[model samples]
Target: MHIISGHHHISMLSKDAKLNNHFYQQVLGLRRVKKTVNQDDPSMYHLFFGDMSGNAGTELTFFEMPNIGSTVRGSNAITQIGLLVPSYESLVYWKERFERLAVKHGEITTYAGRDALHFEDQEGLRMVLQNNNGEKVPDTWQAWTGSDVDPRHLILGMGTIEITVRHLNRLANTLTELFGYVEAYHSDNEAIYQSVDGQSFGEILIKQDLGPREKPGKGSIHHLAIRAKNEEELRYWEEAVKERGFYTSGIVDRFYFKSLYFRESNGILFEIATDGPGFTTDSSIDELGKDLSLPPFLEGRRSEIEKNLLPID
Candidate 1:
């Protein structure tokens, strides 16, 4: 059986491209790693933020669609995203930084025996900064040279994601049997799953959604991507999912990574993505995110795309 390593990236929707850029780049101190257009909707900007190099597990991306309304929070939606910092002291530093910036945040709290700081972005997208306590901490992606935050406390990568699901058993079985996730912890209404390979990036906390179904819009998670080692592994999953009667998008080339999208029984969008041909494929690492880039097929429309996109600070 083939299993994914962990999360490749998490994509969300945002209303204002400028505000989104400022929050992730300036406030969060993440590097603007890629500037491109959404593959399906070329009119909207698809922005990526991460550690200096935009490593696979570090990415938090967004689609800029100003016309979409805010998301309605309920069942069957990703509720929160977590980023990992180095230590408990780093959590303290962030609490003070959040205060100084007037960002709405909560006092440091403990969850699953790990220290966490809960906060929201300017768009009310819920996020958490947690201390690294997993079995194995993946390599820290380089910090941005111009970041305001200290390098010691910079976010390492994606930590965990929390989502609501109506069919917990089915989702849990698929995670364990098909994706190789192990049940790390469980309570009455919630359960945590971690990759069995001991990778630290793709942990998920799923809670029962006993309420109404969620409405997707801006500020909602668009899709969660899991990492495949390469094209062979990606095709393995595509075949596995298709055989199981799950509808898959069937290996779509994302330029950065090949992707296969399928929504599970709970209606949460999941993507299987390859880890190679990364953000630096077209642009050198030193020049990434400085210019608008398009896939070779879309290069003909570069002029139109440039005119449509708003400037990023």
Candidate 2:
């Protein structure tokens, strides 16, 4: 059985919460599904952007670190994030939209035989809009009607995340042996692995780079989270990771989903999160991301958390 379902979410660092929210919501046309604080560090904002419903595979989250420095790009890091759009035509729509909005982006190009548009957020967070023309997967992401972008051109979900590491064999072995990811494609220095039936959203592209370790700050990808079907599956992974002699964070309840965190041998953090008890656990769909939502453990300090967070409007 495939333990890792797909890309649950990719979390990054942002120096400015307001601009980050604006670029993602107004520019990229994603919905702010959740507004909360980082449980590990509640002073900083933990903002989540995804489809209207905030499905498991659609999330692109950020932790607002106002004083963080710029990211010094190098190896041993998640190099880029991939967002899936409906078709190749959607790339044209986004290209024109980015030009009009003055957002920096590259021309539509092919990556791994799929049409992709490379772009960067205001903070220089790297991302690619990949074409999901005929992938056989459930249509679970609900389109946000409020977005100015047409529903047909709306981003479907998260796609293959690009991770660059020095010791490719060690990381690749961990993924295939520990997580049950199968090698779908491979070149000399690059390899693609899929968790579920070679689905695009379930893929991870690994690039072997011998550069220095990345100095993470603003615009740096913090972690890549893969999906676990439920709490039971989450526990199984936690034990599985521990038994393999790797240190783990164990099963941590994030209120919405339980999570297990561990850094692979390459020093890249990976999170296994449950799919159940979603964002609606505290607020309804309509009310999602409108107000700050905290887990039960942090509810007592709501006032303090709210006061620290800068307004994102």
Candidate 3:
């Protein structure tokens, strides 16, 4: 099996573009790396945020709707997003910062032997600042100098995400058998899986839940993307998934990356995307996200798209 390195990016839904932009860019200090429209829904804005270079593992994207309702939490939903910080001291710095900024956060706690600071964004997306296990590659991150957040303390990249499922066996088997993920740890209710390559970005925790189902709305994850090296690998994954009786939305060209999407046995949406032709493919890196960008197909309708999108500032 061709192994998935880690996360390419994770996309979520947000109701308010300005608030989402302010929270991610100004509050969390991530750089607004790309400003584009949702390919599937050209009228809606798609925003990308990440570290300075907007590398694969650091990306967090959003679909701006302005009026979407809140997500209902239950099975089949991505529950939390984990951001990796360098050390225990980094957690301390965030604790003080979250308090001063009045950001809602929970007490720092240790899970699976590492410390974490749990918090929520303005849209109530659950997030955590967690310490890495010293296995991450240093190249996975580039410094973000966009805000007062010290380069040393800025989020390194996306470390992991938590997903809730009714049963763990099927999803766990798919991850380990097909995706080359290994069971790092497990309990009756939760299990942690890590990529065999030891990359931190796509690590995931699957919580076994037998309660109510989750509803999708604003602040909910639309899909989690795992990294594929190229177009060939993406197609390979699609074939593999189809053979296993899973329905995959065969290779999609998103301009930045090619994608293949499918839901796991438990119904959580997952996407496999390539790592190249990134945000700088159109706009220069230095001027990324400064202007609204669209795919060539959508460029013809730029005037119509812009008129409908809410102004960012």
The pairs that clash in candidate 2 are none
TM-score of 3: 0.96
lDDT at 309 for candidate 1?
80
**Runs in model 1 lying further than 4 Å from the true structure:** 133-135, 197-199
Who wins the TM-score comparison?
2
* Alpha-carbon TM-score of each model against the true structure: 0.96, 0.98, 0.96
The model with the greater lDDT, 1 or 2, is: 2
Per-residue lDDT of 69-100 in model 3, one digit per residue for the tens? Answer: 88888887888899988788888888999899
Candidate 3, residue 35: lDDT? 89
TM-score of 1: 0.96
CA lDDT, candidate 3, residue 286: 90
Q: For model 3, what is the alpha-carbon lDDT of residue 143?
A: 56
Question: Positional deviation of 35 in candidate 3, in angstroms?
Answer: 0.8
| Candidate 1 lDDT, 199-262, residue by residue in tens | 4477888888789988877788888998898999998899888887899988999898899999
What local lDDT score does residue 180 receive in model 2, on the 0 to 100 scale? 89
